[model samples]
Target: MIPHQWYIVLESREIKPGQIVGVTRFGERLVFWRTTEGELVCLRDKCIHRGASLAIGKHHGDEIACPFHGFRYDKTGKVTLIPANGKSSEVASYFHIKRYPVREKLGWVFVWWGESEPTHEPVYFDNVDESFSWSSSRHLWPVHYSRAIENQLDLVHLPFVHTNTIGRGKKTLVNGPVQVVRDGNIAFWVYNEVDHGQKPKKAEDLPPPDFSRQHIHFIFPNMWQNYILDKMRVLVAFVPVDESHTLIYLRVAQKFVRLPLLRKLVDFLALRFSQVVLHQDERVVITQIPIATQLHMEEKLIPGDLPIITYRQMRERLKNV
Candidate 1:
């Protein structure tokens, strides 16, 4: 969508060792694989020699051999050897495909979708330490990546769309002031004392609950994080397949549950519960007509829509950049 510098398309675990995974992102067919040395490679899925899908090819050590013509391509997307040509043939010099830069961190695979060399490392949760355990899942949404992203920045939807779970009988009206701040491509939102059907209390009149703080953040393009509590966090990334489709990756990070057996139990229960909540959001977001449309033309907004409005504006600015 935005002229890509870098877009995260999948988690590192999804692309296993010696395995090639075909990903259709931003309207392009990409093949991701790990070489024998454990390095990750991403290239157009189409073989340069005869246009065969590389996804159907086999991996030979650090190279992928085309199934149709037996043309072997190295991890760099360069033709290493073509059976149709002589061993001394310079054919490998002339046939090469585009190679995208990829990096794996925090169990996620990040691909640079833009033209320039990325100067910074991919973002990860620095706050996660020995106290936390993490697990993730992936879902494909039949909606634009922008739509999926806007849904994350939207705080107003919780009471209605997620009322049964996250909202849990809370007030539907958003009466608090929403704050937005940007640090480079990352943006953070703080919704203070938001009304959720409970009686409003004065700031000085209340004691802090076990997990009272609420915050959400957007890491440019398609990553989002919600600090649900001091011990729990949710990380989401939207992968664009085209103008009207996306693959959503969800990860639940948790802390304070230190016992090995108990951690596994907690993660399992938390992941399933989170999946239900996410599916509800997906059902509503994916069913919207036209997928992603001009915000002004699609719906009128009030104060509660401030986060959505800010998100759109930031997206527009990134597009222009």
Candidate 2:
């Protein structure tokens, strides 16, 4: 079942100022654009007149003019002007498109992909802001969006899947209990301790060590954030291209501290580092068979999979609602 809520569709940079891009997600053809004033809007791509794709049309300042018959639409999906029609009444009665609500936050464009009004505003991390430096990349994968999302929520596979890279030398099984917390549409999983070979210890084994922690948060439908530490973070937004394909937007966020040279250097390194880690995850996720299969009755899950179960149940409940 598909969860009904706003999903992160693209990184904000994918649609530049005054540029319009066509995106097909979850069987919907959408036109995403930024106004001259830098506001973002997303609407159904099909024009009411002649069934032309509005994404292939031109943008005149704030309005998008359909290329086929010069039908113009405003950001709200109302046909503001129709060149073929003489009066406004005719255009008003026949020329409207479905417009989805869009909100820009933390360098990403979020779209309400469901039928109902979103119950809450999009969530943002405390460290995400203009002061923080960030860079992003986009990749289209041959897998369902749910599979891509579940890959992020799985902690037990990291030690084996990413062994040569991010998970090198990490413990295979985590010792301490995994902590799970939720608020509305947001869910977070924190693995506090790793088996260090001596004896099973609690999360607070080294009393007040450092500011290092492993934290991953999934905000509703399609956004996931992993905090490697205080200074580095990885944010992933998954957009469903179809039932069997997905587009992934990866953002690496780091503290800049007002130093231009250091910021540039950090941003460059972060982008490369993120790409390496992402490719590792993608290699495994895309190879999974039966893209749209549900996990409720297939496998034997244990306590380590509590987070995954929670996410799956939430998705099922939301879809039923």
| Residue-wise C-alpha lDDT for candidate 1, range 17-48, written one tens digit per residue | 97889989889999998988899999998888
27-69 in candidate 2: lDDT tens per residue? 7789998888889999998888778898889989899999898
For candidate 1, the 10 contiguous residues with the lowest summed lDDT are 202-211
Score each candidate by Cα lDDT. 0.77, 0.76
Candidate 2 wrongly placed segments (more than 4 Å) = 1-3, 87-89, 185-212, 256-258, 293-295
After aligning candidate 1 to the native by TM-score, how far in Å is the CA of 35 from where it should be? 1.7
Candidate 1: where is the Cα deviation over 4 Å?
129-131, 184-212, 294-296
- List the pairs of residues colliding in candidate 1: 4-113, 4-114, 5-114, 170-196, 171-196, 171-197
RMSD of each: 3.7, 3.2
**By lDDT, who's the top model here?**
1
